[model samples]
Target: HSPYFNGANKSTEVDYVQVYKDVADLLEDNDYDDGSYGPVLVRLAWHASGTYDVDTKTGGSNSASMRFEPEALHGANNGLKVARDLLEPIKAKHPNISYGDLWTLAGVAAIQELGGPTIPWRPGRTDGTSAESCTPDGRLPDATKKQDHIRNIFYRMGFNDQEIVALTGAHALGRCHPDRSGFEGPWSEQPTLFSNEYFKVISEREWIKKELKNGGWQWVDKNNTDVMMLPAEISMFNDKEFRKYFELYAKDQDQFFKDFTNAFAKLTELGVPFKGDEKVYKFETLPVVVT
Candidate 1:
């Protein structure tokens, strides 16, 4: 009887377009970092899904396991509680929606609202009831590590070189917080606006390795000194294969959008068991207001 329901599978019947709008409306706040929760929301979806291991198929956003202990306290997921807590009211509003679907959809909303690509999304993921479904520590990429480590982590999730490069372009959005990641600063000058800037910075800037007061290492742009890159990102420049893709993305924003949409959609869907008939929804982006 309700327009939001087909009365068949309840998960598929919930109006996800409204959910997207709800999440979009909460992305900005003056007190928050760079004035938006968009970046961290993207990270929430990424860490939730990036844990998938192709061999065992044990991890992914399907469980929304990060809400539990161990995974919530994971070092890689540090500071993500802000993103989760921000979405809590939405979860309360849409009681029937799965945490997995809500988080991943929030990610799609963040990207689109921040001027990135439209991510194809759907619902059907069910929440894991307890901490037993949590992924082990170290499933995420370590910023201190090199290209080899990046490959090992992503390869386990079934992404190849190009997809890996496309996914890393997400560094374009958020900054590393000193208290959270033990690193500081953003990869792009405009950290809140999504673009090809992450790759462009890598290609254009001369990065000088700097040791933080926290005893961590990151590369600062030799000229600007404010923007930074983690060692894992610098590895993209050093590795021949990785370099090829980032370089291309630096020159072409359209290509970057296309590849990133595909790779990120794949990342979020990992381990999700969607009934074949569930419709894929592409929510409309909010209109820009010109000054």
Candidate 2:
């Protein structure tokens, strides 16, 4: 019963439920952004897996390749070291668990702890050895690009239009740091609590394009100017295909939660090799906060 070679090449046993708890416990920090590391942890998991190339079958979360300098130093990955560093202690405590598993699971923990849906997840990713495993640059979507560019990026990762829109709804959490992404502000007023606010923002708010002091520009709310949306996010509204789903999500929080969770679960699991019979773990979330 111990070996249970779920998907890893070697025999290993991991108590993923305990790992989930540990990651969840670490989500809150009064010193970090939004007093929670949830958003960046989600970003870390996303960047790690978003590199997948469906045609070539290369890249993805399979190897936890971001541990190598080449991938970590990639422009799209800027500032993710903070997420990795936070999870380092968790990794150190559980040496048998691969970085691929830890990073993805941490993302799930972040979402659930932040009042999002429970993500279906399993383990079986192993770390790669060298920088050679790093995916090429430009694989991740550019925040400055528009609809065509957004489609090109996500399409390569095998996401269709609906999934594409559901995935981008993740922007609801965490603000963009000007120092990191050369953009600033949260897409939603409640940046820490995950909800359909991002969809609502895209559909309802009138955004004004603001030129940042850093020489880059993003759309800020016409009224507030504090919250913002990337050019790529705006594309969701302009494109007829992408517009359909975000419009639906903005109106239906339950449907948004369902689709977003499914899309995100798929995102984290991209290219991860797991045995067909591997247990799908739906880790329990913290009790709902009564505010």
Candidate maximizing TM-score: 1
TM-score of 1: 0.95
The parts of candidate 1 lying over 4 Å away from their true place are 1-12, 289-291
For model 2, give the RMSD to the true fold: 3.2
Per-model TM-score on C-alpha atoms = 0.95, 0.94
lDDT of each: 0.93, 0.90
Model 1: lDDT of residue 17: 87
Clashing pairs in 2: none
The window of 10 residues in a row where model 2 has the poorest summed lDDT is 2-11
- Writing each residue's lDDT as its tens digit, candidate 1 over 1-291 gives 875565556654577889998999888898998999999999999999999999998999999999999999999999999999999999988988999999999999999999999889988799999999999999999989999999999999999999999999999998999889999999988999999999999999998999899877899999999899898888868999999998899999999999999999999999998888888999998777688
- What is the C-alpha lDDT profile of model 2 across 160-266, one tens digit per residue? 99999999888888999987999988888899999999998888889889998988888999988998999888876899988899889999999999999989998
- Pairs that collide, model 1: none
User: Residue 236 of model 2: what lDDT?
Assistant: 64
Using lDDT, give the best candidate's number.
Answer: 1
